[model samples]
Target: MKITLDRVNENFHFKLKNERGHIVDVDSRAEFGGSDLGASPMELVLMGVAGCSAIDMISILKKQRQEITSFRAEVEGERVQVGEAKPFKDIHIVFYLEGPINEDKAVRAAQLSFEKYCSVSKTLEPTATIHYKVVLNNKSL
Candidate 1:
């Protein structure tokens, strides 16, 4: 997979393009770009991880005969600044599952997705510390 980034202005704003010709704009706080409109490279990486896990978890739950009422994946990253590079040293994922399914089964499904299913998590494992937790119905149970 190859992507190209083009500078949109003299500022930090840029346009990203993939090999498939899809384009997305990225910018910094100096511009009017907000989180929803633009994201930093690190934010994009976190988003990729979250999106991958969400897809995997939902698919796994569906296969497990669970009906999902609501699902949310929140990801937080801790970055280590070394000179000019800022890499994510730790990443935490909170998987929120709200439904009538068994809590244990839901947790297991999410764990499986992070450990074995999500490609993003697997790819980033060697570089970043990835941790995940499943919260069911506002309780640990």
Candidate 2:
């Protein structure tokens, strides 16, 4: 599990490649002289948290024998204005799951992710508090 970054421009733009040779374009925000090329590093980090936990939830629910028709996550990171290092103060992840899924199972899956399964969220725990919610069939659980 290793990745490398190759500078693509004089500015903050760069190409990130994983060990599998998968590519992800990364760039700083325009305010930092980036050309709006790709996602800012912070944005990608937050996205990683979302993706990691979502995968965990899906796996957990599937093992619980729940049928999942559609699922998406909305993740938000609140960062503190620290000079040159604006780390997130907290992160909130909301999962929208549509299917014949049991509400309790859905909630439990999310809980399992935040409490034990999601590695990315656990990594950020020291620097940021993580919050989670599950919405099933348009109702918050």
For every model shown, what is its TM-score relative to the native structure? 0.85, 0.96
Please give the TM-score that candidate 1 achieves against the real structure.
0.85
Q: Which candidate number maximizes TM-score? A: 2
Question: On residues 24-115, what C-alpha lDDT tens digit does candidate 2 reach at each position?
Answer: 99998888899889899889989999999889999999998999999999989999988878899989888999999999999999988989
lDDT of 1: 0.85
RMSD to native for every prediction?
2.9, 1.0
Clashing pairs in 1: none
For residues 1-141, what per-residue lDDT tens digits would candidate 1 score against the true structure?
899988877667789999999988787764434433478778889999999989988888898899989999889999898899988889998988888878888888878887889898888888799988889888764
What are the lDDT scores of the predictions, listed in order? 0.85, 0.92
